[model samples]
Target chain A: MNAVIFNGPRKIDVEKRPKPTLRDPTDAIVKVTSAGICGSELHMYRGHQKTATGHIMGHEFVGFIEEVGSDVRSFQVGQKVVCTFSPVCMCCWFCEHGYSNRCPEGLAPFGTQGLAGGQAEYVRVPFADGTLKSTPEGVDDELLIMMCDIFPTGHYGAMRAIECFRSSDLVNGNHYTDLDSPKRSGLSKSQSLEEAVFVCLGCGPVGLCAILTARSKGVRTIYVVDSVDDRLDQAAKLGGIPLKLGRDDVQAKVMKATQGRGADAVIEVVGNNAALRSAFDLLRPCGVLSSIGFHQGDLPFTALECYQKNLNINLGRAPVRTVFDEAMEVVAANKEKLASMVTHRLPLSKAAYGYEIFEKQLARKVILVP
Target chain B: MNAVIFNGPRKIDVEKRPKPTLRDPTDAIVKVTSAGICGSELHMYRGHQKTATGHIMGHEFVGFIEEVGSDVRSFQVGQKVVCTFSPVCMCCWFCEHGYSNRCPEGLAPFGTQGLAGGQAEYVRVPFADGTLKSTPEGVDDELLIMMCDIFPTGHYGAMRAIECFRSSDLVNGNHYTDLDSPKRSGLSKSQSLEEAVFVCLGCGPVGLCAILTARSKGVRTIYVVDSVDDRLDQAAKLGGIPLKLGRDDVQAKVMKATQGRGADAVIEVVGNNAALRSAFDLLRPCGVLSSIGFHQGDLPFTALECYQKNLNINLGRAPVRTVFDEAMEVVAANKEKLASMVTHRLPLSKAAYGYEIFEKQLARKVILVP
Candidate 1:
C-alpha cells in the first residue's frame, strides 16, 4: 500500500508500506477513503515536533471497514465509518466520563502510536466498537471526514467559551435556584448566545470553523484575527468580521468594538504564546478563554493576571468523540458552508504536494483521497 | 491614632498617625476593635512586595462604625461590622457578577490604595455600603475578623475545588440533564463531601482554615502537609491526617492513602512555585487545583501536562464579599475550632512585637486590639 512518510525535518515522501492487519479481537481494518491534513500535522512536517523517519502521518480519516476481528460487535466488514483521531475503549474512566481524549490507550493517533496511518490503503483500528462511528445518512464525505477531528474540535472550543458565561452566571446568583431538582441544568437558559461577542484567533481551518460554530449558536459579533490575507478573507466570507493581525492592534480594536469592554469569550485556536496573551487581553473580567490550540511549554499568562482578571482559562484537547454526534448534525445542516473549507483536494499519491501547499498557507484545507 | 507601618524589609513599627477622616460620601470611619495579622502581610514585611515606608499594614479587621458619610445607607454609626481584605464596590460588573476581588477600585486592601489600614485606632473605608458587612448576632470578634479574609478565602478555595467535580460531571453527563434549566446549582446535590479526599499544602492560618472549611463541608479524609510541628499539631487537632513536609514524601503518602489514586482535590495555600508544582502532582487526572496562595511568577506546570491530565487549575484571589455571609455562618458554627487559630493577642501599641513573633512562626495567629 502507498502511504505518506515523514523522512526528517521539512521532508516527506510517498512510500510503499505493508498493509495493516487486525491484531486484537476488538480491532478492525479500515480501507482508507478520505483524510484531511491538520494544522497539528504541520508541526511535525516543519520539524517543530520530533518525528522519526518513515512515520505514517495522518490522524483524520473517514473510511469503510474492510475486515473486523471476531470480538468486534458494533461494526462489521464493509460498513462505512468515520473514526476519531484518538481511538477510545469507551469503558475507561475518562471515556465513561466523556473525556476520551485523555483515555490511556486512546491517546494514540492513527500514525504515532506504533499504529500505521490512514494515508495508507489499509489501517488497523483498535477498539473498533468504541472508536468507529457509522456515517449518518445524508451527510457527505467531506462533512464526515471533518467529524473525525476539526469540526468537533472547533465546536468544543465554542461550547467551552459559552460555558464560561454559564459559569459566571452560576457564581453571580443570576440563575440556578433549585439545588434538589434533577431537571435543573447548570447554565442559564434565558441567557441567549445571540447576545455574546466572540473573538476567534488564528483564522485557520479550526478557527474558521469555530466562527461558524459560534454563528450557528447565535453569537452576535464574531471577530476573526489572522496574519494571512487569504485566511482572513475566507473568514470574512463566512460572516466573520475579519481583522488583519499585524495591521490592526487587535486589543484596541476589540475594546473599541465592545465599547471599552472586552469580548465575552475568546476562542484561541493559535497555540503560540502571543495568541494566548491576546486572548487573555481580549476577555472582560469573568470572561472565559477557551484554548483549543495545541500549546507547548509554559502558560503565557501569569497566575497574577489570571487572578486579577478573574478569568476562566479552560485549556485542553477537545473531546471530539463526545461531541461528534451533535457536530455532525450542525455540519449536515450547513454542508455547503462547511464543505467550502475544503479548498484543495488531491489523490494520496500527491500527499507531498498537499503538505507543501498547506505548509505555505496557500490553501484553506487539503483533503487527500485514497 | 497609632498604626503598624511598613518601615523597611524586616522592619515594622507602631507609629503615631493622624486620625482618619471620612474622604468619600460612601466612606465610613471604622474604630477597629480587633485585627488579625495575615500571611500575605508577611510579603510586604519581608520586602517581597514593594511598599511605602509608612504605609499602614493590616487588612483583616472587625470593628464598630465610628462615623458614616452622608451617602452611606446600610451601615450606621456604632454598628458592629467586619470588612473584607479587598474592599469592593458591589455595583461594579465584577462585584455584581460575584467577582468582587477583580473590581477596579476594589483591589485596594485598606492600606495599599492610600486608604488607611485597620491596624490603627481608626481606619477610613471606601465603598462602605458594599465593603462592610454588618455583624450578625452570636458571632465572636475572632470569627468575624476571620471572615474579613482567611475564612472566606478558605471557603472560596474549597468551593472552587468542589466546582471542579461539578464541571467534570457536567461534561461527563453523569448529572445535569438540562444545559439551560437555570434551576440547577453548580455542584451535585447527590455527591457527598464525605466521599471526597482533600489534600491541603501549607499549614499556615489560611491552610488550617481551609482544612476547617473542608471538614465543615463534610469531607471525610483530609491530608494536611506542613513542615512546622506546631502547625501540623494544629492540623491534627482539627481532624486532619497531618504529614510533616520534610519527613515524608508528601506525594507518595497521599497516593498510598488514596489507594494509588491521587487526591480528588488539592488546595495550594502556599504561594511558591514548588508548592504549586506539588499540588499539581498530587491530584488525580481531572482533579482540581484551587490556589488561594498569592504566587509571584509563572505557573510551574506546562500547558501540555495540564491538557494531558485534564486539570482544572482555578487560580484567583478569593471573592471575599460574595461568600462573606456563607462563611460567617460556618465560622459561627465552628467558633471554638476557628478561634483556636488565634494563639496570641496583643494591644495595637505592641504591633511591632506581634509582627516579630508571627514572622518567626511563634504564633499561629496574632490579634491586635486597638
Candidate 2:
C-alpha cells in the first residue's frame, strides 16, 4: 500500500507501506477513498511539533470498511464512513457526557504516537463502533472527509462562541444598530445573534469553516483577519469582511463597525500569541474567545487582563465524534461553498507537493486519493 | 463622619472625614448600619494591591437610604438596601445582559480607586437604581451585608462550578458511585449534581459561603481545603469534609472519594499559583474551575495544559447586582450556617483590630457597626 510518511523537518514522502489489519475485536480495516492534509499537520511537517522520521501522516479521511472485527457491531464490511481524528471508548463517563476527546482511553490522533495514518490505502480503526460515523446521504467524499476533523472543530468553536448567549432570554430577536452608549449614539443595547458582531482571527481552512458555520448559525457579520491576501480573498468570497493583519488597522475597523464596542465573539483558529492578543483586544466587555487553536505556549495575556475584560475563554480540541453528526448538517447545508474550499486534489504519490503548497499558503484545502 | 482609612501597608486607622454628598443625579446617600470586611480587601489591606493612603476601606455593606437624588427613582430615603461592591450604569448593554460588573461606564468598586468605602457613618452610591438592592423581608443586617459582595460572589463561584454540569443532559438524576475507568472500578459513568463531587480550594468567608451555596443547590458532598484548623472546623460544621493543606494529601483524598475521577468541579476562591495548580490537578476532564479570586500574577498553567485537560475556566468578578436577588435566596435558605461565618463584630473605631485579625487568619468574617 502507498502512504504519505513524515520524513523529518519540512519533509514528506510517498512510499510503499504494509497494509493495516484489525488489531482488536472492536477494530476495523478501512480502505481510504479520500483524505485531507489538515492545517494542523503543518506543525509536524515543519518540525514545530516533533513527529517520528517515518510515521503515517493524515487524520482526516473518508473510507470504506474493508473488514470489521467480530466485536464491531455498529459497522460492517463495505460501509462508507468518516473517521474522527482520535478514537474514544463509548462507555466512559467523559465519552457519555460528550467530552470524548478527553476519554480516559487517551487521545491518540491517527498518524502520530505509533498509530498509522489513514493516508495509506488501508488503516486500522480501533473502537470502530464509537469512532466511525456513516457518511450522510448526498454528502460527497470531500465534505465527509472534513466532518472527520476540521469541520466539526470549526463548528465546535462557533457553538462555544455563542453558547453563553444562546441560553439568555436576551437572545430572542433583539437587534441593536448602535452599541456605543453615552459617547456616540446615546442609546445602547445588548446584541442578539443577528445583531452580534464576530471576528475570525485567521482565514485558514479551519477559520473558513468557522466562518461558514457562524454564517449558517445566523451570525450576520464576521470580520476575518489574516496576513495572506489570497486567504483573505477566500474569506471575502465566503461573505466575511476581510482585514489584513499588518496593513489594515483591524482593531480600528472592527471597533468602528461595532460602534466602538468590540466583537461579541472572536473565533481564534491560529495557535499563536499574536492571534490571542488580537482576540483579547477585539472583544466586548463580556465577550467570548472561542479558541480551537492547538497552542504550544502560555497564554499571551495575564489573569488580571481576562478579569478586567470579563472575558470568557472556551478553548480545547473539538470532541469530534460528539459533534460529528451536527457538523455534517453544517456541511450538507452549504455544500457548494465548502466544495470550493478544495483547491488541490492529488494522487497519493504527490502528497509531498500537497504538503509543500499547503505550507506555502498556496492551497486552501488539499485532498489525497490513495 | 467616622471611617476606616488605609494608612499604608499593614496600617489602618479610623479617622474623622467630611460627610459624602450626592455627586450625581443618580446618587444616593446611605447611612451605614453594618459593613463587613471582605476577603478581597485583604489584598489592599496588606499592600499586595497598592491603594492611596487615607482611602476608606470596605465594600460590603447594608444600610438605609439617608438621601436620594432626584434621578434615583428606584430607591428612596429611609429604605433599607444592600449595596453591591461596584457601581454600574443601569442603561449600558453590559448591565442589561447581566454583566453589570463590566458595565461600559466602568467598574469602580467602593473603597478603592478613590471611591468612598461603606465602612463609614455614611457613603454615597452612584447609579443607585442599578447598584442597590432592596433587603429581603426578615433578612438580618448581617446577612444583607454579606449580600453586598461575599455572598453573591460565593454563589457566583458555585453557580459557575456546576454550570457545565447543570446544562448537561447527563445531570438528570443519575448517580454513579464508581468513576474509576478501565483501570479500577470499570463501571465509570457521569455523576449528576446530587451525586457529583466538588472541592472548594479555600475556607475563607467567600469559600465557606460557596460551600453553603453548593449544599443548598443539591450538591451532596464538598471537600473543603484550608490550612487553618479553625476555618476547617467551620467548614466541617457546614457539612463540608475538611482537608487541611500541606497536612493532608488533598489530591489522593479527592481521587479516592471520586474513585479516581477527581472533582467534577473545583471552586477556586484562593487567588495564588499554588491553589491554581491544585485546582488543575484535582479536576476531572471537562471539569469547571470557577475562580473568583483577585489574582495578580500570570496563570499557573499553559494553554496546552488547559487544552489537554479540556478545562473550562470561568473566572472574573461576580456580577453582583445581576445576581443580588438570587444570592439573597441563598442567604435566606442558609441563614444560620452563614451567620456563624461572622466571627468578629466591632464598632467603627475598632477597624484596625478587624483588619489585623482578619489578615492573621484569626477572623473568619468581621462586621463593623458604624
Worst 10 residues of 2 chain A by lDDT: A168-177
Tell me the tens digit of each residue's lDDT in model 2 across B156-239: 788767655443322111211121221112123445687889999999988888888888777898999999999999989888
Q: On residues A185-256, what C-alpha lDDT tens digit does candidate 2 reach at each position?
A: 212344568888999998898998889888877788899999999889888988899999779999999999
Stretches of model 2 off by over 4 angstroms after superposition: A168-191, B168-191
Regions more than 4 Å wrong, model 1: A172-178, A182-194, A233-239, B172-196, B236-239, B257-261
What global local distance difference test value does model 1 have?
0.80
User: How good is chain A of candidate 2, measured by TM-score?
Assistant: 0.92
Clashing pairs in 2: none
Report the Cα lDDT for residue A28, model 2.
92
DockQ of model 2, rounded to 2 decimals: 0.31
